[model samples]
Target: MIRHIIAAIATLLALWAMVFMYQLDQKAERFRQIQEIIEKSKQEVPVQKTTQPIQQIEESSVEEQMKKEEDEVAKKLKALRERAGSAMAFKVSPLYKQKCSSCHGVNGEGAIGPSLIGKSEADLYKALTDFKSGVRKNYVMYGLLAKMSDADLKALSEEIATFEEKLKAAAE
Candidate 1:
């Protein structure tokens, strides 16, 4: 009975060893195949050809294109500035200068008030109107802007919008 038990244990150990060796061989074969593929790919050389120069546009055509672009840009800028000026001069600038400038500064750059220079006309108008109507409650500005006429408000808005343009043109 002792001899039979010893034989059985030996047989099991041999089987496990065979299985482990087979798995290692399989992994080695896979690695070898990968290396071969890499070596073969590296040996191949790509063909190179002389590239043709890109065609250039005629001088006149180029000039015309540039002119067209300039005109389009100018038109777009003018339209944008006009709209901005109209809104500033009409709705917000005067009110801001009168009521808020002592605090915010003349251009909304902020002194005692927050900067108004870049604030949109619509935003300024809405805030002022809200304050006047009690939709917004600022103790100081509310009372001040409330007394301003609609026409005055509009002119202020327009003026604020155009002020930057005037400054830029002057600088140039």
Candidate 2:
């Protein structure tokens, strides 16, 4: 009877030892997996750093594109303003269109009215003002000049200056 009891105790201890060994192996495998995950996360750090430069490049490219578009818009606006200034000076002035165009031609190469292409602002202002104030009377120009305001006269003078500059540049 004592021998049988000893044999049963030995069998239980063997089973317990086997179970503990298996659990230890499982824990070691889990630790190894966790170590592999940590290593993989470390490797991704360099990749994240590299992506920062790419993001900066993209941002700079967007800024460059916006700047290019703004430059194009500014160029177009300048061209339009230049064209309008030329038109106002040579063709679209109220006096030119209403009274002078019939004799001065569209660009002030005169048909009956004198060519006013290179006239100074002071001369033009004096003539227009005299016409307005009845100091220099003309049946045709007096009515038109009297209707123009000071702002209109100034704008016309500026347009003439712009036209002269454009002509000078073109001649050069």
Give me the candidate number with maximum lDDT.
2
Summarize candidate 2's per-residue lDDT along 40-71 as a digit string, tens digits.
66432122223588787876777678779768
lDDT of 1 by residue, 46-69 (tens): 333335333233544565787797
Candidate 2, 161: how far from true, in Å?
Answer: 3.7
Query: What are the runs in model 2 whose C-alpha is more than 4 Å off?
Result: 1-99, 169-172
Q: Give lDDT: candidate 1, residue 135.
A: 91
The TM-score of candidate 1 is 0.38
Worst 10 residues of 1 by lDDT: 83-92
The alpha-carbon deviation from the true structure for residue 133 of candidate 2, after best TM-score superposition, in angstroms, is 0.9
lDDT, model 1, position 160 = 57
